[model samples]
Target: MKRASLLPAGIPIGIASLAAFATAMIGGTITDLGPWYDSLIKPDFTPPRPVFPIAWTTIFALCAIAGVSAWRAAKDSRTSDTVIGLFALNGFLNILWSLMFFRMQRPDWAFWELCVLWCSIAVLIVYCGRLSRLAGLLLLPYIGWVTVAGALNWEIVRLNAPFG
Candidate 1:
């Protein structure tokens, strides 16, 4: 038996990539780096400021690849639609976290939202795993990053609470 292409011809991986890029860009734009953010008391383990963009860029790229792979691998249109819906939901949660924490300057609220984000990642991993193991594997790093991010969000809230 022959293996199918990871991304079928005319499957529009470009569109998926573009959507992921847009999501990342929107999240980045919402993340403010001004006096308020600088004033927050971060934990010792917090990565250097420059590390964030690089890390997020890589993660988003992997997410796009995983999404396309899973979509292509889906055995039926219902499965493909499910993959698309899950990815769309994850993207929404991803951007919402940035808005909650950075734009609103409320790490407390962000911490709660990150819980939902983490769950979305886990769901993607599980569903994508059923479709394509490689796709699921690709999402591992994303969950790891989100784990670290959740920890950081919690610490920030702990260190600087009572937001206005």
Candidate 2:
């Protein structure tokens, strides 16, 4: 068995890498943790700020790898399309959460959007898992991070209400 056969109909790994990294870049750009964010009341469990970039970098890298694996593992074009679409949607939702919470300074609205973002991740697990178990398993950390994010968002909303 040769590895070449696996990628016969697959997309270039760079495309997957670009898609994944682009999401991170966009989201990072939208996030502004300046004085406004500093004034907010965060939960006692808030990890050191450094934890964020490290985790996101690792997650996006995993997502890129998983994207390629899922693409190549797809046995049919339909499966391939579905896999790509799911990843794309997840990226959009990921960015949207950043825009809502940090840029808009509305953790309240962001919390609602995060719920939708969470659902997208769950869907990715199902679809990506069916295409490639490795791809699906790789997303577990993403969901975990989002769960932590959800808790943070909820706490932010609770601690700082009456946003203008």
Candidate 3:
């Protein structure tokens, strides 16, 4: 038996992990749980403060795994490049949502932005699924969490409109 010739194993995982970490850090910085956020009327379903970090950490780990799996499974450089590009775009959108909601204190803006995030996730699921079923499946939890977040954002906007 001969070893298969594919892209170096660790590179994709490392790059993807680094990108995910950077995105997480940026989003975390933008997410201020200060008086402004605490003052908002959150939905009863809002998870405890501790839940956010735990949830995002788990999701980001899965994202890195999914990206690496998809890249490795790609048949050609073009496909792998596409996967990388999508993940990069998703990271940007992820940080933007945090900036809009937490930094800007505008859940209304973030709610709309969440729609774009949801679509990007959908694209990842579909395209990654095409490359690797497990990769696509891994993204399911991310989408579910984002769906909940979107609903929560919508509720916050509804509960407390006219944000300054």
- CA-lDDT, candidates in order: 0.91, 0.88, 0.92
Q: Candidate 2, which segments miss by more than 4 Å at Cα?
A: 1-11
Clashing residue pairs in candidate 2, if any? none
Instruction: Give the 10-residue window scoring lowest on summed lDDT in candidate 2.
Output: 1-10
Of the pair 1 and 3, which is ahead by TM-score?
3
What does candidate 3's lDDT look like per residue over 90-136, in tens digits? 99999999999988888888999999999999999999999999999
Which candidate number has the best lDDT?
3
lDDT (Cα) of model 1: 0.91
Error of 2 at 13 (Å): 1.6
The runs of at least 3 residues in candidate 3 whose Cα sits more than 4 Å from the true structure, single-residue gaps closed, are 1-7
- lDDT for model 3 comes to 0.92
Model 2 C-alpha lDDT per residue in residues 1-164, reported as the tens digit of each score: 33425554444577788887789999999999999999999999999999999999999998888888887787777777888898899899999999988888888999999999999999988888887899999999999999999998999899999675
- Which candidate gets the maximum TM-score versus the true structure? 3
Per-prediction TM-score, please?
0.94, 0.92, 0.95
